[model samples]
Target: MYSRLSFSWTASSWAFALLLVFPIIALVYEGLKPAEEIFQHLMATVMWDYILNTVLLILGVCIASLLVAVPAAWLMAMCELPGRKHLQWALMLPLAMPAYVVAYIYTDLLEYAGPLQGALRDVFGWQNSQDYWFPEIRSLGGAIFVITSVLYPYLYLLARTSFLEQSVSLMQSARLLGKTPTQAFWRISLPLARPAIVVGMSLVAMETLADFATVDFFAVNTLTRAVYDTWLGYGSLQAAAKISVMMLFVVVLILSIERYSRRKQKVFQKALTHEDDSRFVLLGWRKWAASLYCWSLVAVGFILPFAILINYARYYFAASWTAEFFQYSVNSLVIATIVALIATAIAVLVGLYRRLDTRPSTVLPSRLSSMGYAVPGTVLAIGVLIPFGWLDVQINDVMQWLGMKGPGLLFSGTMIALIAGYLVRFSAIAVGAVESSINKVSPSLDMVSRTLGQTPVKMVRRVHIPLIRKGCLAAILLVFIESMKELPAALILRPFNFETLATYVYQFVSDEMLEYGALPAIVIVLVGLVPLIFLNRSLEQAH
Candidate 1:
């Protein structure tokens, strides 16, 4: 009897999960269809440039993010330096700033006509680009810098947790072997945290791969840009779909590596007892130097960019603070809120199924639902358009047959497509969050509820949902933030005449008028702070 009930629940959960997974399947199906002529054209012309640029960007960002994140994470996790507590959360502030917004802000401040180079020319009596050496902010290296500055937090967040969770006994064993604290960290702590670090690196690699605005703004030709240019520029959706398939293969490889790394887990017998009491202490210049280094990352990543935006807002408030801007903000919040609610509901269904059913039917869909998170926004946008566009055409034809006027593009050319894109892109965050919280609730609780004459649905509502409320809230906030900051998908999927803050910012950015959009950009970052603060507080309480 229980088996029959479980089967029904599993089937229903799979159906819901597959609904979330359909867009990805549509993308793959579209990509797999024949496009031999376009494929040959790409192979002969711009394909290698796209491939090479994407590879180089991922490699550069991975190395740079590790360099920035691992050291700072170690400092905050292991060493007790002045301001260490503040720097720990402060380092995470970058996660709130979108890389493209940072790219625009820094480019504005660093370009020749901007304040930095202008002041430099005045001070050094330099005349032009040829006068003295200045690193171009609109180049590949600048994209790496801006992206790494914002993305390093992915690594830092995981690596620091791994470090803090290290068994104290292991560190003491290293010390007993006559190793210094630094040596112990190098040999013992770092090795123990390798899997976590690699997991973070994989995340950074995925983000670097998915990014479009930073690369597109800098005119760096990547696979993401290739998709955009191929579709919108050359008006070849087939070619764009092909490029997206290639990107999907790349994402598959990266996700495989991440999964393999995560599976190489270490079991520590010793558990955390006291937090600050177990940390290493730093003294004098080393203490100050550590603080300076950590603080510098925050300054460059968030503080400086934020300061520039505030300055721009001061002068541009009248121009930016208008009805149109308010509508854009409303559009952003409305779509994001709807997406968050839907994603969270889907997450709860799938998450509970995975926790209770323990069957292949329930498990596979739950896993496959997350595959979209690795897919680049531009790629997902292409993937989403194919089926939604076809569905719209079919619906229109049916309406005409039924003797009613066709509502053209009822799905593809409206917020429905945009919401679909957001759900496909960010539902994984919600699933992961809710799954984690579900895992923490003991199985005995479910058993108790079942023995007390409760259905699985009632068990979830009365027991699981209340327990995982924090995780559900986190998932909602996270999806909301990501939806607000998302640019490429929103740019492609938004209805005619509709604009979100991200799309609005992209317009001014495309016009090389990012300063005009600076205020809205700042608002996006400010809104992002809600989650960052929540995350930091969560981390603090965990410790």
Candidate 2:
């Protein structure tokens, strides 16, 4: 069962996975320090508001997501209307947009000085904010709407897939039992899709918790905001670490609910071999309504915001077009490219270990490695800083003891920390992608190669790599896009004066000057579209 250096691979895999988790361990270790003074101060001030806002944000997103996603998913999967074909994939376009980008764009449009409210005031012959009532786009409710609009696509994608895969036979049986199409959907389709909905909500919940820029921009206080403010605002890393620990607890609770829901999920197998021609056919007003619903989501979530960014770029071209902008773009690309390669390599190694070695010793590392994807970037950044900062100090101390000039923060003060934080945060994307491809290969092929006197390493090199080349490319592309868009961790861990496209856009956004940053923000959205378009084509082929 052993390949050449199987021991080496197994040992290294475990070590690497452990290294990924060590940051979280470090956070917990640092939280052991006294934080009572900071905690008491926060409790007396904004802590309760943070808790309330965060909970309300999660609940609001969940409700909005369900309302928006379920009907859209049903329409795309089960009904055929005008442009239903295009809307099926168009609904996923929002998946490429960062929620913070959407927030920035919409707030710019809907706020008092923006076109929407200005037009409203002009149409109503109103003079000022005191002259009329308008919904504020910078409140908790606005944060919910902006984030949910962009993020509901997560729910839509999964819920649509679930709807498509539902048992046609069961739906037919419901119809046979004298139920109308609507009743059958309410009774059978929705219940069957519950697990997918739960999974989607869990994704939304985690993303909501991870959000810093969106909430920060809206001036909403959430736990993620509190962590950033406590650390960067108060000059207290200890308090920051404690708050991060608390945030991790929230993640754990989310994951626990996900696990429990998954355990109760019922899987339904397809009983019929062909498509049921009896799909709920829409006509007249219903068809138009369905079309309106699906198109509205696509427009609000992607098309409108994207168009606004383009307009801003056109109008503010001089402000946004400069050498600094080019360098920021290049810096982002270089970092994402590097992190993607490293994360992909780690993913491949750990994935191969799991495939070739069945022992618990080898398997556990892979499982451990996958856990970091769920941890928030803020928590991951703090976790990274605590340990890496300590290690840098030890190295400098050693240099001083040897009568040599001490090097400054080697790992913590440079790109090393940023890349490390990225890998720890995003490697799971690569691991899952590669492992999926590896699993599709037949074990019999491996056995035949082994019978021909090939070592396991050689057999994998010969057989597995060629088969999963597409999957590997897809993994690299995905991780690259994610790294490009990643912000919180990059914000905390980047070297001073270093700027990625995300951080650059964020700077303008924070200063309320997104006009000058519009082009880069558009570049980010366009870059993210690469993988979404690829995945959309892939899903088409699969269907």
Candidate 3:
């Protein structure tokens, strides 16, 4: 009976993993077929430019994120600064503010007729156009800046954790050997944190590559934009799939490089004690400088954009508070709730399977299911359409053959495709959370439960589920928040006349009228903050 049960679990796990991964497989198959005329036209005209722009955007964002994140991380982890407790988590708030939102706010603030440039012209006694030079906030450089501002926190969180985990003994030894604080950081600390930094940079690069709204708003021609244009603009799924294949290659390359960098490189450090002596005591100017730098990042990244939204929401509240706004908010809430529950359920099932089964192959389901998180949303959207669209076609054809009215566009034309795209993109959050929680449960508990004659299913229901309930809740909330904020997939896969808060905000932002969308934008940011707060508390407790 036990052997049969194990086989059942194994099959179920593989089935779920394959269901989640089938879109990418279908995408590759479609992409490998003969190219459409539009794709050939793109290859002849501007495809190389799109590829170059994407490469440059990734490189720029990675470099800029490193520079911003490393110094702030070092300050927070190793140096004494004012408001350190609040500043530590405050740095992460920008992750809640979507990059496109920030781009809109900053462009409004800095454009020629906008407040900043207008004030500068008035104060400096400048006349008309070309009187002075101000950096354009709608160029490739602008996209890099706005994206880096929001994404640096990924590197910050990882790098700070790495710095905190380093042995204090190493720093003390370096200081005793006549090394200054900066020298010690360069030699002893930075090298040890290199692996973590590299991992963080890869994440930032993937995010920058996946970015569509900010790049599109800025009118930059990157691969994500190409994918969107090819599919929707030219109505050629084949060309879109081909472009998506290029993006998949980029994603795989980034992950490969990150893995290769950490290959055979390992560092072990003793638990960091909560000792004040571990931190460098900044004095006078240095102290103020550190404080200013940390706070500046918080201000630019989160506070300013958020503050602008608040102001807009207050004045435009009457305009934005209507039936349409309410409907979109409800739509976002309902879909996010459904996706959260389903994704968390999948996480629990696969997680328990990994824990119970001892075979090496049991690990593949969890790994395979998590790959969608790294895929760019536009690419994932195309991947999803290829298979689900075909399924919809098959369903309709069979119905017509049976002399019945066809249910038109059942899968690909409804919320089913949207939710599936979301699950593929965000299920990894729940899986990672559940897996981590499961790892904390002792194997002896499972053994004891089994020895008591409890079947695996019964043991899981009574023992595993109850114990990991908190992690499960966290997983649900994280997935919910991510779904609320996801724009590209929502934009591509939403059914006719269906709008989420993300799509609603993007619509107004695209029209250069953010005031109308400010209220919904605030909702997205507020929903996003819940997970960051939970994450911060968890990290605090763990450290």
Candidate 4:
């Protein structure tokens, strides 16, 4: 019995092991070629430009997002901001806008022939492109603006928690020193929130570095966009893989730095007491200013995009927006729901493995599970295709040997492949949420339950489940929203004719029909809003 139990545990661990490492093997194997080839590509046609552009995008998005998220999180979390309860979801609306979609919208809105410039031209009677001062939306700055608008929510979410988690006693101490609320936040809250902020910024940086669609849409030629160009345009998968390997090294370095900073600071805090953090009243003009700030964020993130979408949706309605739209929406919801559940399940198993807390045992699986967050969507899709393709081939060969014919059941030519790709991409969301919740579950509770002669599984089910229920729900919603928002991997890996709401929007936008695309595109954002709101509500309750 003991041997069987031990083998079962080991089998479980090794099963997850292959799931984690196989994709990485695919990435490395594809990238490895003669060093001469890699060096030649690096030397010819401006690798430095690619690197520089990528760095600039990361830096610009990081700085701009911080500027927006920190102040917003501070106002909402620390002050008595009016309508804080309702405004939370509104603040997070930009997250639903894929960076590529944002690029398309802004380019159309700001371009010479587009509405904004056309209105200006009608007002001033400007004749040509050079006649009026209009910034090109295809430029680096334009890419930065689109990315920062959508990505700031990452920083906002983390910073909100850090703010809400600020010790009430520390705020009182700061007040006794005669510091104002703003001063206290900068001096006290900001410093304390450093770790969480770093975590958030790391996520933003990694995401910016990994983005392909946004850079591709803007035609800015970052490393990610370059990778795709080499792969598809030049028909050099080897060269693309090499570029990807180099990019992977950079991401690994960033992740390492983040881990080091987090370790050095060790600035994790759980709310031992949920006391209010000395909320200051924003009276009269101050209140108006605060409300205006929130409104402006929502306007840029939500209202402007939505209003335009609504205007164009009238056209779709006139065309009698087909039943196909709802069909695709249902398809998207069904897939998103399944993938989110599976991702959460994988996360639960991974978390449980960690709770076992055996040193060498936990190390590899934990690291592998976190790899999803660091990998680009495109790379992950490629990774999924390689292994699943090879696995299908191998299975067919084995079946042939056995005098039986079989097509690839789990992977090839099915919705399962799409879901597998999604799980590979979005598993990090589940892991982060579940691990945090599990950490807060004290060992003493388990100890007491074990003393009552209940089995460990029963204790976890009856006691642990109830305590960590909020975290599980949050994790599921987070993963669901992320999967719904996911594009590149889904675009690449979906079986023929499989369309999600994201894919529907992408099809129109890809064809340069942003106006016609606006309706379903808005639906994507609205659907995403539901999960985002649920996540915020969970986080607030957890605090």
Candidate 5:
């Protein structure tokens, strides 16, 4: 047994691991002061509402993603729908649309002054919202619909792969038993696909819990929105950290259920890749109807939002588009680019480290590092604050000792803070993508190199890295998309006078000016989709 870790692996491994673990520890430490304080706040005013809303949101997102993703995945994988080739890419396009962005777009269209109501007003000759009845766009149910519609891509991707790999023999047996196609799907295929659904749904559930932008935009008082309020409105990091831990508890439970559900299930073997020989050719009306449904889904998910955004972007040509705004965009691009590269690089090492080691310490680091993913962006924003404040204090003290002014606020307030925040929150995505791909690759490739007496580092550099290129690329794309769409953390952690598209939209929406927010909101959606396009393309080809 060589039992040797490379220098690059050791250093990069610990750096990335500590990068994730240290902030959480600091948060826990900061939060320890008043168990009573956070709890008291939780009990009196908003806890029940927060808890109830969070649960409903998670439930809604799960159901919605399943409805959209599972059927579409099955249809695409099992049935021969027209435009299936191009439609596959379209299905994933919605993944690029951020929840907050979609919420903004939906709210805009359905709002009293927006298109839908205006159209109704003209058609029915009604001038005010009071003149008629329509469902409120900002209500709990609306939040669920808006949020879930955009988040279902996770389910679509994972479930599609799972369905593609299902054994032909199993479905064949069901058909032989005279089960209808629909019955086969409901009974045989679905039961077997449960674990993959659980995996995909777990991500969506966490996403809903971790959501700050969508809930806040819809004025839903979920825990994530509460985390922001606790930290900013009251100046209480301890309270925020404690509340964050409450959300973390929910994530842990969902993950537990996921693990338990998946306990006996295995990723299907290659031999199980079955073609649907008895599958119905959806002909004439059914065929066109199926194609229409799939295409319409992509339309709502990708095209409609895009058209709306471009509509507002035209307004940008008349309004907020300026040299200064472009400069800020450049600044965002620079930080986003650096953070993506650094986080992905670190993720590669952590991913590789997992491949090489089975030690308890190594496994713990790998697992705990991903715990950041479960932390909502807003909670993570609060968690990162303790360290930043602590660092600033120590640095200022050093500056005082040097007979100079306090330490520069740049580290605490500006691009540095934003970059650090992105790395912490988004790196989990990067690690997941890289780790999945690494797992797919056979470890025997490395064994062959090792038997030839190549060093572990050399083995990775020459063998593992090249083979896992697709996974790495996918990971980078996922992280990049997520970072672009990030809202809660960026909203709270960004420096003075800084604005990303998400923050820009938030500023207007929070102020009750939906029109003011519409353009930037669209920009965010358009940008977020680019990587989603890449992600979906990767998924369709994953087989």
Candidate 6:
């Protein structure tokens, strides 16, 4: 009976995993089919531009993010600076500010007729366009800057954590050998932190590849924009799928490079002490420069855009706070809540299956389910519509054959599709959180429960669930936050007349009237900040 139950559980786990991964499978299948005319046209015409732009964007963002993040992370982790405590967490605030939001704010401020140029004209005593040259803020370079401003924190967080974990003795030994601080960092600290930094760079690269709103707003012809245009503008699913496959290729290449870079590299630190003596103290000019540099990132990334939103909200509150706004707020809340609950439940099941099953293949289900997180939102949306749309058609056909009026678009044209997309994109977060928590529970506990004749289900409910409940809560919050901020998926998958906060704000942004969307945009930022609190608390505990 035990063997039978175990086999049943294993089968169920595999089935669930395959179900989650089915969209990507379907996508690959569709993309590989004989090329439709639209796809062939795209390949012959503008596809090279798309590929080149995307590669450049990702490359620029990764390099710029590294330059910005590594220095800030090193300062926070290894140097003594005033306000370090507050600044450390504040550096992460920009993660809450969506790239599109920042893009709009900067464009408004730096446009030809905007205040910055207007003021420059006043100072230079010139009015016409030919008077002076200013770099355009709506170009690829601007997109790189805007994206790096927010995305640098991915590298900053990981690099900081790695730097914090390094042993003080290593730095001391380098210093004793007459190495300067910069030399020690280059020779000793950086090499050890390369794996962590590369992981951060891969994350930044993926995000740059996934970005649609920012790149689209800047008029950069990246593949994400190409996918969106091919699907919505041209109404060709096959073309969109083909473009999405190209993106997947880029994503796979990035992950492969990241993995290969760290394949044989491992650093184990003994005596991981971070006493004051280990820190390099900056004084006078250096102290001011470090403080200014860190604060500038926080200001440009979070404070400036956020403060502008507040100002807009203050003036436009009466117009922005209306029945429509409230309705969209409720819509966002309800959808995010549902996605969070369902994603968390799936995580618990997959995580527990891995914990209980001893076979090496047991890990595959978790991995398969987590793959969706790596897929760009635009690609995932296309992948989702293919399978669900077919299912909807089949359901209608079956109903019509039974002499009943078929329900129109049950899965594809309703909230179900949106929820499924969210699940595919964010279930990985819950799975990772639950797995981390479950790993902390000793195997002895499971053995003791088994010896007591507890069934796997009961043991999971009474033992593992209770132990990992905090992780479950964290997972729920993380998924909820991500779902709330998700724009591209929501934009693509939402049913007619459905408007989440992201989409609502995006509408105003697209119309160049972000003042009217300020309230909802602020809501997005504030809600996104919730996970950072949990993150900071975890880091503090680790410290």
Per-model lDDT:
0.87, 0.87, 0.92, 0.77, 0.77, 0.92
RMSD of each: 2.2, 1.8, 1.4, 3.9, 3.2, 1.5
Q: Clash number for every model? A: 0, 0, 0, 0, 0, 0
Q: What digit string (tens of lDDT, one per residue) describes model 1 on residues 40-135?
A: 798898899889999999999999999989999999988898988789999999988878888888898888798999999999999888999888
What is candidate 2's TM-score against the reference?
A: 0.96
Model 6 Cα lDDT, one tens digit per residue, 1-543: 123247778887788788889999999998899999998888899999989999999999999999999999989888889999899999999999999999999999998988999999999898777989988999999999999999999999999999889999998898789987678778988988999999999999999999999998899999999989998899898889988989999999999999999999988897675666788888889888999999999999999999999999999999999999999999999999999998888888878888887767878988988999999999999999999989989999999999999999999889999998999999999899989999999999988998999998999889999999999998999999999999988888999999999999999999899999999999999999999988998898887
TM agreement with the true structure for every prediction: 0.94, 0.96, 0.98, 0.85, 0.88, 0.98
278 in model 2: Cα distance from truth in Å? Answer: 3.3
Better of 1 and 6 by lDDT: 6
**For residues 226-245, what per-residue lDDT tens digits would candidate 4 score against the true structure?**
76666557755567667777
Task: Choose 1 or 5, whichever is better by TM-score.
Answer: 1
Question: Can you give the lDDT of residue 245 in candidate 6?
Answer: 89
Clashes of 3: 0
Off by over 4 Å in 5: 6-12, 35-42, 121-132, 265-272, 276-278, 354-360, 398-404, 408-410, 436-477, 511-523
Against the true structure, candidate 2 has what lDDT? 0.87
Clash count, predicted structure 5 = 0
Q: How accurate is candidate 1 locally (lDDT)?
A: 0.87
TM-score of predicted model 6?
0.98
Candidate 3: segments with Cα more than 4 A from true spot = 1-7
